[model samples]
Each structure stands twice: as structure tokens, then as C-alpha cells.
Target chain A: MDTYYKPEHLSHFASIAEGNKALAEKFFSYYGAVFADGALSVREKALIALAVAHTVQCPYCIDAYSQECLKNGSDLEQMTEALHVAVAIRGGASLVHGVQMLEHVKKSSM
Target chain B: MGDVPLLPTWGPDVAGPGLPAASPRAVRSLRSRGSELASAETQIETVSRVDLSAMPYAGSFERALRENGWARLEPAPIEIFQINLGKLCNMSCRHCHVDAGPDRSDEVMDPATVEACLAAIDRCGAHTVDLTGGAPELNPSFRTLVDALVSRGKHVIDRCNLTILLTASHRDLPEWFAKRGVELVCSLPHNRRRNTDIQRGDGTFEKSITALRLLNAAGYGKGDPGRRLTLVTNPAGAFLPANQAAMEREWKESLEREHGVTFDRLLALNNMPISRYLEWLEETGNLKRYMELLVTSFNAGTIAGLMCRNTISVSWDGRIFDCDFNQMLELPAVASDGSGFHVWDFDPAVLAARPVVVGRHCFGCTAGAGSSCGGAIES
Candidate 1:
């Protein structure tokens, strides 16, 4: 079976720079700065990245951030809770759309 | 104490209840398993297999030192004389770089060797004596060695596996150590139970907590310099440890809030890739990446503080090494003539002038914040 996602690609992420080096460099530089310790700890940033990875359903991000989270000292319980935050948001996103449908039905009926 | 779980005498088969799915294999030394990695040569070969074509210093530890203007690592007057009593441990933690376990009982230091070590200590001028092993307390002469060191006016440290203090015979060790003013550097992989147990064995966390409570009752972890209780945490898995200061804060808050356990400080260490840990890295297919991580994360700032520069590690039988990791890999500290030196022949001046040994495993020490037996080298 042909697979779209390859585990090895995660390690080869730098290859994305091949097509446009300057832009990729800027993005990477910014990305590195973004994840660094600030008001939010590196561990906290990693946890946020983990939750976002799950929301975006990016396997590369998931793999990268899972290791990153662990490396930054986030435990399994914390990581699992971060994933649930993504799940809740993603679920709420779909459910909130029900309001639009409800408004449409009330206008169309009586 | 009655509610606390008792340590198993041997393997993972007798691990406590509610063991995580990832419980480690039966307690046995790599030597007994006849693993190729049991040989230090094979371990060195494995660590050297990583492709460092793109890495600075070409992933060569010695070359990295040279390139960074450290032509050699020479001892700064010995401050710590670390003794590896033996490998006779009750629990065979998966990430143990020593390959220590109950099966290693035969490897304990004999009385003659202990006497030789004391003689060396007298001449070495080290203010601190660090006793380490599968469990240093398990040694029959542990108290004898401690009393000897104390009488000589040396500060003694016990690199304790917290669970060992909960064992039946060793149960009173907390108070015993407190009485002697011995610093207890206990290993408790995490503040939480799950990660701690996963790396160690089942019920290890509970046993550790129970032991900590005992230590507390004995007046440890109470901000008393005389009763200092230091906790050492290595990453439970392949990753480098978090910032020591940061992790110490978090560990303090969490442990105190949740378990009502207090500790003086935390020492975050990087797990060296050797022995049983090296085996786990290979089996999990993380050997290559973990090695690369160590190489690329190398911080030159950590060179001066490298434990090998100031500490002399004496093996159970009196052989000497730059540090404990080197001792496990059988890399003896050599003399000017390139012959392996022994504790009995220890000459502080000669040892000080000798260049420290380097290998691929040295990268583990220099990685990230840099790790040592004491903790991260850099702030």
C-alpha cells in the first residue's frame, strides 16, 4: 500500500528549504525563536505545540512535538490532557455550527 | 512502613502490582545475558556508528575538545572520591547504565579492596567520598566504609536508590544515614508515580514515597545542611533532562502539593548510553537518533565542569576511572606509561597531571545542559 505519511520525513524536515532557502530560513528562525523560553516555558510551548499538532492532525507535527514535549519534560498525563483540549475545541467547533442551522430552520418554518 | 511494598529479591517477574505495560525485563546483568553490549568494546563500537558527517567536530569527542580550545581535560585537584561498591541491586531499572542487579552479588568489593580504597582516600586529599552501586547500602561493608570515611573527617554521600531504603534489612538506613550526617542522593526518576515506576519497576514509586516519608521523619529534606536529601532525576526515556532549576521548582511544588513530600533540591542528569540503557536504545530503534541528539546538543561550556575533571571513580575491586560511566565501560584511568592504574597505586599528583579519557560516550556528558553524577553542569 502507498502511504502519504512517512515517519522518516519528520527527520528530513529541513529539506523543505530546498525550493526556497531564504523564506524557509526565515520561517525556521522565527519558529525557533517562537518556541524558546519566554513568559511561557519551553515545556509549556511544547505542550501547546502538541495540542495544536493534534488539532491540525499533522502526523509530522505530532511526531515532532511528541518527542519535543517529552524532551522538554512534559509527562504523559500532561500530554494527554493537552490532546483533550484539542479534542474539546474541535468538537465545540462543529457543535457551534448547529446555531446557524437552528437560525436557518426558524426562519424557514415560523 | 507496613503499608509500603517490599522490594523484590530478584527480577521483574516479582514486580509489584499495577505495573505499567512497559515493565522492564527480568532482573539480570548484561554480563549474565552474554549480550555483545556486555562488552564495553561493543558498546563503544555501537555509539561510534552514528553518522556525524554534518555535525561540528565530526562527532568526535576528542576532536570537539581540541576544536573548542581544550587541548586536553586535566584534573582540577580531586574534590570527590567516588566508590562503586558493587552492582548488587534489588531492582534492575531498565535505563541503568551500570547493568546492576541482584545477580551481581558476587561483584561486591571484598574487605581488602575496601581497605585499599580507604588508604587511597587518605592520600587523595578529597573532601567528599561518594559511595554508589546497584545500591551502595546493599554492600556488607557499607557502614564500615562510611564510618571509616567519617572518622577521617570526609563528607560522605550515598547514591541511594530510594526503594532500597524500604527493603526489610535496609529499612532503618534513613535514620542511620541521618545520624552519620551522610548526604542521601536518592534516585527517583520522577516526582510522579507512573513515569517513575515505568523506568524502574512496578510499585517503585510508592515504595519511594514511603521511603521519602521515612527520611522526612528522620529529619531529612528539612533545609538542614546536615540532613540534606538530594533527588536525582534522569529522563525516564531517551530525551535529555529538563532544566535543573526549573524541574526542581516543579518537582518541589508537585511533590509537596500532591504527596506532601519535600526534598532539598533536584539534580537533573542525562542518561548515558551504555550497558542496559544502550540495549534499550537499540531495541527501540532510537540508538541512531539519540546519539545524534547527544552530539548535536553538545555544549562546549560544560567542558570545564565535567565531573571527570575533579572526581576519581574507584571500581569495586579498586580499579580507577575518570568517572562512573567510564568505570562501567571498563575504561580504566591510565598512568603516564599507558598501564591501567588502581586505587592502591593512586597518586593524586600523578592522576591530576594525567589527561582524562574520551570516547563517543563522552558526548552524553556534554549534551544539552550537560550531565554529571551531581547534576547539570551548566546553570
Candidate 2:
């Protein structure tokens, strides 16, 4: 009976569309932790958002995280550095599979 | 590209006391050229259904847009137009907000309607001409519109669905766009094929990559200055776009290292509630939570920058609106009535004097980072 969504038409968000009370509570908990200090400042969260954004791989998430990073006083340099970490991990994850190929090649050559 | 008729000729009402009527679209041009947009407030209030929302999400959307005016920008430099030529798209992404698919034909705008739209563009003097559709390329006249507009020195933006490129008939689309200097605004939902496929359908992400590659080969997104290219990001469900600037860098780095793809900028857009998204909310029963996200993230600062403030949305059928969002909902384009030129009559002086009709939906733009055609309006 509650009508929150308007009809102008763009993709809706997960949290908005799911509306689970449990999730809301969890969000309240994590949202606090997300901003709270634990080796990550508000500025750092912005950078992490930029990095994790790619890892989780949501375009909307990336957009939000990028802005959050900027607002927390992180400059472009810090943001890019964070994204580099993601790129390195993502790239390394794919390349590391070469171990299987290497073992197969060794067996064949033998 | 010049000399080609981008739109029919329409003169400003101020040019002379009594110039001929332009077209219905000319009435919609009020979003741009602020001086001419709000000269007549009372007339607009009388003719159109002031509010168009089927839902009662926000209390004061119209009031906010009227006060802030996204479509009211100088010459209206709208970052994204997201023009829906009609509801007829080739691909049927489940999360499509416009509910565009091969089946939805009732809303499609014909070619004559497009010409009327061209006239409105001239009156508004908007900088970017964003062409969208079921697949904008699916429309026979899509090419002509781009060719005509680009020639007239307008920035033509096309929200391309990648699959269109893979089709045999659309094979030369990349070249056609390149020849016209059209900015290829594309979407992939997620770089990972599985994620994209789950939401968009099987093989979508792969074909998207192929389309992107074609664009890259055609000099789009390849770290080149001569060609302009951009990508759009919207959440699968209700959420604000991931931070645009950093996201842009991430997209550039990952796609390049993996697929040798690169583009100029990445635009993050928040999803609004309309069409297919509405159906999704109803079918899955998640409407309440989605609204909370929008309300919680409502950025008052961003509201002033909502795209409708300065951008005028012209429907495929010649109706005008403060933004494309408003057009989909059937909100009548506000008209300025100084010279007695009504909705269909293009009188610049009269058109310039109209006040915008605001509604509850305007809150979508006011939310965090403030949504606009390009991205965040304030940040």
C-alpha cells in the first residue's frame, strides 16, 4: 500500500527495492561501522569505496564511492591509488590461474 | 554537418511582437533559456495536469524543481539527455526503467514528431542532443537525427545497447556514429559477464564487449582527444550511482587492462521509479525499502542541480517537459503565455514566461550528490 517509487523510470537500487526490516537494521549497524574509525577515516572510506566498488562491481556503487572519497577530502591521487589496489588484485587473480596451465604444460612436455 | 536542417525554423517571440507559432515543442523549450522559460506562470498552471505521479513518494517535488530549475541552465548544458525516441528497444533488460522492449510500441514517436522536437531544440538552444530508444539505432530515423544535429553543431549523445552493434544490419553503426562525431554513451551493467547476463540476459555482456571494441577500434574510449566517448552506470536495483569520478578511473583501468578499452568519462546516474522499475518493485514487493534509500540519501544541495532545472525534455510526440523523467510520466510541458501562444504555439516571449509545474518526484534529483543528466549536479 506504500508507494515510494515514482514513474519517471530509471533503474532502482537494491536496498530500495528489497526493503527488508532485518536488512535495514543490519544497514544501520554497518552504516555506523562504515563511517566509524578502524584504520579507515572518512577520507579513507572514500578511497576504499573506489577500490571495493570495482571488486563488488556495481556501477552505481562506484559512482557513490567515488563521490564519498572526494567529499572526505581525498584528492584524485588517493582515489586512483585505491582503485590501483583493486586493479592489481583483479588482474593478479586472473593471472594466478596460470599455475594450472603451467602444470599441464610441464606434464605434456615431460 | 551544417546546412542540414536540424529542426524547423522557429523565432523567439521577442524578435518581433508577432512572429508565427513555432510548434508544440517550442513550448517545451522553456527548460533552457531561463529568461524566456518562466515569463508566464499562470497559463501553464491552468492547461496541464500539474502533478503526474501515480505514487505519492515525496511531498514537494514540483516546488523544489520550480525553486531550483535543473532544466533552467543557461542554454541548458544538460550532461545527459537520455532521450527516449519511443519505448521500442531491441533488448529487454529485466531492470529496464523505461520498460522498453521489442513489444512496447504504444509510446514510440514517429519521424514527424522528431522534426517537431528538432524545432524545440533550436528554441531551447540545448548543448547536447542525447538520442535514446528501444534501441535508438532501431529507429529508422535515428541516423538522420544524429546526422542532422551533428551537422548543426550540436553534441549528439546516443545511449547504445551493445547488442545492436552485433546484428548484421547494424554492423556499420560504429562507423556511422564516428563519422558524425556522436558520443557513444553505452552501458554494460557489470564488467563481469555473469552479473551482466543475469540482469540483462545471456550473452549480453559479451556482445556488449564486442560493441565496445568496435567503438574503440572506431576511436571511441581509446585515450584519444579527437574522439569523445562516455559510459553510463546505474544500479541493478534502487541506489545512487557509484561515485562517478573514481568509478570512471576504475572502469578505465580495468576495461583497458583486460579488454584494451578506454573512455573519456563515466557517468553515474541514480535510478528513478517509473515503468519497468515500477513493475519490478510491485512484482518483488520491494517498493518501501527503495523509497527509504531515496529519502535517506536525499541531498538537499544536490536538489538544486537536478537535470530538470536547466534541461527541457521533448517527448517523441512533440510534448515538452522539465526533464525526460517528467515526460515519461506524462507531465505536460509548462508553457509561458505572454504572447497568447499556447502549448502547440511556439511563441518565445510567451514561452519564456512560463513557470514550471513541480511534483513529488523531483526529490529524485535532490538526493545525495544531486542527480542530473551528466551526473551529480553539485559535486
Interface RMSD of each: 1.4, 9.9
True contacts kept of each: 0.60, 0.00
lDDT of each: 0.89, 0.62
Off by over 4 Å in 2: A1-110, B1-59, B62-83, B336-344
Error in Å for residue B324 of model 2: 1.5
Candidate 2 to truth, TM? 0.63
Clashing pairs in 1: none
In terms of lDDT, the poorest run of 10 residues in model 1 chain B is B18-27
Q: Mind giving the per-residue lDDT tens digits that candidate 2 earns over A5-103?
A: 343222444355365878777776877787764564455676777798889876667766765654433444567778889999999999999999999
Docking tier of model 2: it is incorrect
Ten-residue region with minimum lDDT total, candidate 2 chain A: A5-14
Writing each residue's lDDT as its tens digit, candidate 1 over B232-322 gives: 9998888898788887887888889998999999999998999999998998888888888899999999999999999999999889999
Q: Which ten residues in a row have the lowest lDDT in candidate 2 chain B?
A: B22-31
Docking category for candidate 1?
A: medium
Candidate number achieving the greatest lDDT relative to the actual structure? 1
TM-score of chain A considered alone, across all candidate predictions: 0.91, 0.75
